[model samples]
Target: MTASGRSAALYRTVWRWHFWAGLIVAPFLLVLATTGAIYLFNDELNDAVYPELRFVPPAARTVPVSRMIGAALTAHPGAVSRVDLPAAPDRPAVVFVAPAGGGEPLRVSVDPGSGRVLGSLVYARTLVAWAEELHGSLMIGTVGDRIVELAACWTLVLLVTGAILWCPRGRWRAAGVLWPRLTGTGRRFWRELHGPVGLWTGALIGFLILTGLPWAGVSGDLLQRGSAALGVGYPASFRTHAAPESLPMKTALGTAPWTLEAAPMPRSHAGHAGHEAPLPTDDAGAIAGVDRVTALLAAEGMTGGYRLFLPGDATGVYTAYTYPDRPEGQRTIYVDRYRFARIGPEVRFADYGWVGRATELGVQIHMGNYFGRANQLLMLVPCVGIWLLVVSGVAMWWKRRPRGRVGAPPPISGTRFAGLVAALAVAGAVLPLFGASLLVLGAADLLAGMWRGRVGDAAASGIG
Candidate 1:
């Protein structure tokens, strides 16, 4: 092959990689973008969908949280596990109840103003819950989680390769290259579809992938552990004066700080470990249960939507935490159940190590929750842009694809091809799964080439 042919060969090689990777990632991209966009409006959507359960009239003083929990327990058969406080007076407090029989937890929304049991739903069966599960694992558990992670890894690789192919070298066109041409047909139209959207929103899509990886299964674990090892993550030694409790906050609460998910929860000794004469309430507060904890949290500057997880046993502490849009308002607090005293120092956004703080902030931006509705709209650019990329990509493939074939780019063998494949090592090193797939693809390609050459040799022998 000549110089241009060699370049074409390299281009074809990358094009093949992009083409196959896009096909695999396209479906997942659609699912993620659609579900992610929906989740961005979780508060508004939930309020709209479940107005009776979620809303109440504003009052000068709403009923106590204790009364709200009481109402929830009266309407359901279970102990209160966690109570998600209302953001405003007009919204109800959602009390999560863990059934004595041991199944999915029940969530009861109670009006704080009137202390009325508005309604109940299974914890995992709510619309938001369903969407969350689908978003996390496609509702198929660990295998699905791995698939999603792999898809995410590949999506990043696709972004890199797509940028390479999209940028014109040795020649440039203002119309088809820089922006989509309004006047076009067939491949031109598809190029118009793929080119501009990919050009503009490509970086944002990459941002979404990186931000989301913290919640992924395999790669996420690698990142967390790696960060911890580097000493830039949440400090394992945060000057905890409390007991060395083994239960992590993530294991205890439904939502926790991204940094402290694996860190052990601060614990306090049981007040009623033995013969209990009903231990006297300490200086923390006169009240107990949800009311005391809520008061304590409110006093501690947790004025936003927060959850107060009730103690499960004698040793369990009440964990109050806020996972809001902006990281600056986020805090995780712990209170001893009986003594009502704080266990450890109040964990704020400032407490997070460098990596933790960055990750948390990125997570907020990724979800479009950092700046309210405007933030949501801004983050939505990539989500909608991905749809356009996928549609245009498929269209371009369909219009030009060879008849009765998958229509992958034709292969060429040369030093350039070898060098290009070698260069992918850097990418593979960064993304282990992507690197592994590349190796698998390379091996398969080698085998297929050998098989084709042998068949050709046999045909020549027969003709001679």
Candidate 2:
């Protein structure tokens, strides 16, 4: 085969994969991009949507954190999981309450200045919450998580193939390569539009995808374990203060720093190292006072919007962490519920090590939380660019596809099957979910091709 033949084969092979991968990834990417873009301003959006619950008048003297907790508990009797502190004078404090027995947590808004309960809403019921859930897992729990991960893994393949298909080939002409030409119509127009948008947005979108992978269920877990194996993953937070059977912090709190999610929940064990007493009962009144925890945190120079997770039972520790706009301010510290002693090593942004630190940095930037409004706007470019690619990709296929059949590009025989297999093999090895799906896709493609061949033979013989 000559150079033209190889080039044609490469184009045909990449185009086929680009088609399949896009089809698989398009819907998920749309949901991710839209929800993710909106969530970039989650704080702003929530405040705008529920000003009454989130806002309070500024006062010269404000009530204590304990008083705010007292107000929240008085309004709704339950165990306080955590409290979201006010970022500014006007923003109200939010106490998250897990109902008696077991249920979803409730967000009880309180005016810090007056120590009055403002309003209550289900934490899981808010708009941004729904958007977040859908973006993460399509609101269907574990199955949805797996699906989303699979979609994300395949998206990488889509990007790789798209890059090959859109790369500047032969002589670079500004008309279709550098920018879209407005003079074309139909498939020509879409082709011109798709290439330029993809070429410009590919790297950004790829960065987002790679960064966001750490949040995925399967790939994220592998990456976490891989990093740990390489001595760059696990951190000091993994050291348990007490029982090995104790719940993981992530399970107990529903969220933690990505690096510390699997760390054992710290307990307040008061003993001389060797001997430890039996765990105490779960009683709300028995735990340390919120004022003491708040005062201690203040003394430690914690001056931002921190989520103070109040202890539930005797063995529990008060977990305080800040969800700051930037990664540098990240901190997760625990205090003994009864003794009020600091428990375990405090996990900070610096303790994340190299890989963990890098992951967190990427995650912050991905969410547009690294640099405030400017970061949000910068991230929006890729989201808009993704939507543009989706539109142009579909348009291109629609204009050129045959009406009767699914318009997947035809396989070029005597061409690059080995190369295609090699690419898929490499992709699968890297992404387990994508690799598993590749087998299914290959089998399906084989069957479909055979079916098409039989139908063609039947037509040739004039047999239905």
Candidate 3:
């Protein structure tokens, strides 16, 4: 084939891959975009919806954090699991309660001054929580999580193939390349819109996907394993001592810094390991430890809105966790319940290894925290753009596709097919779920081809 012919063939093959992948993953992408856009403004939305729970009048003197928790527990029927101190004096303190009878955790808000219970609601039923659930797992647990992860992986494939298809052949034009040609009609209009919009939003969408992969089931595990193997995942201090085998901070408490989610919890030693003498193991000592830790955190400038998860058991440590709007304020400090000594270096954004730091920055930006409201609005552009792309792509297909046909581009065979397979194999290796789906799809394709061949032979033989 001529060079031009080879280029054309390669373009067609990429277009075919893009078509199939988009057709399969567009609905899930739409869901992710919608939920993610909503989640971007989660705090604003929640505050708007429930002002009574989120806001409070500024007061000269506020009650103690312990008093707020006491009022919340007195008003709600559950054990206090965690408390979110208000970032500002005007905001109500939020207390997370785990129901003794087994149900979704409850979020109770308390007035800072009077220690009055403002209101309480089930955590899972909150609007922000629901949006989070839909975004992460589609409210279907592990199966939904896998499906979402697979869709995300395939979206990367879509972006890659779409970029290839969008490459300019000749001199670049303003219309259909940089901006959609508004003057066009029918499939022309949709094509113009889809291609340009995809180009504009592709980078942000890819960043979002890459950052979110750390939270996914299979991909997250792989990323963690890979990071550990490279010695850049958890903090170096995590391996310096024989820490107790405790649940992850996120698992034990409600929230933790992403980098320390898998870091082992350090145990409180009784005057051992070259540390100060441990405090008493009684209830009074626990209370004193809480006060001492809170004071230390305040002295260390652990800002408001940080959470202090009280030690749940004899060996449990007091975890002060916070992921503030500013990435630099992000900190996760674990203090021994007995000695009140920090378990590790106060883990902060600065303490993360290079890979971990990069991930943290990506996560902060992804969560719209890097630049506050501006960040949220900027990220929303890609979310809205992605939705537009999906809609326009579907409309274009509908206009051009023959009736009753799947509208897939012609399949490539020979060397082109081999190249496609090789590309998919590499993607699959990195994204295991995507790889599994590819194997399943390939098997189905092979079976369908055999079936069609059998039917054709049967018809010919009968005529013969």
* Top-TM-score candidate index: 3
Error of 3 at 196 (Å): 1.2
lDDT of 2 by residue, 258-373 (tens): 87665667666742332232222225453337677877888887754888876555566688888787878888878887777677667788877698889988999999889888
Provide the overall lDDT of each model, using Cα atoms, as 2-decimal numbers: 0.78, 0.79, 0.80
Residue lDDT tens for model 1, 1-464 = 68887777777878978999998889988988888888888878887887787778887777788888778777776677677887787878888776656677778898877889989877577677777888889999998898888889899879988998987887787777878886888888888768878998999999999999899877777777688768777665643533243555666554578887766665557543321112212212322466777777778777648877776656667878888778887887888877777876787888778989999999999888888889899888999999999999988888888899888877766445556556688778777776788889889989999998899999989953
- If ranked by lDDT, best first, what sequence of candidates would result? 3, 2, 1
Error of 3 at 137 (Å): 0.4
Q: Provide the global lDDT of candidate 3 against the true structure.
A: 0.80
Q: Which ten residues in a row have the lowest lDDT in candidate 3?
A: 274-283
Off by over 4 Å in 2: 99-104, 240-244, 270-282, 286-288, 417-420, 446-464
Model 1 TM-score is: 0.90
List the candidate 3 regions with Cα displacement exceeding 4 Å: 100-102, 170-172, 240-244, 269-289, 417-421, 460-464
Q: 209 in model 3: Cα distance from truth in Å?
A: 1.2
How many clashes in each structure? Answer: 0, 0, 0
Q: Candidate 3 on 1-464: residue-level lDDT in tens?
A: 78888888888878887998899899999999999999999989988999888888898887777778777766765566567777798998787776656777788899987899999888688778888999999999999999999999999999999998888888889788988898989999999999899999999999999999988999887877677557788777776546444455455554567777666667666533422212212243554456578777888788578887776656667778787777677788888877777887887777777777787788889988789899999889889988999999999989989999987888655535577778889989999998999899889988988887799899989953
> Whole-model lDDT, candidate 2?
0.79
Q: Each candidate's TM vs. the true structure?
A: 0.90, 0.90, 0.91
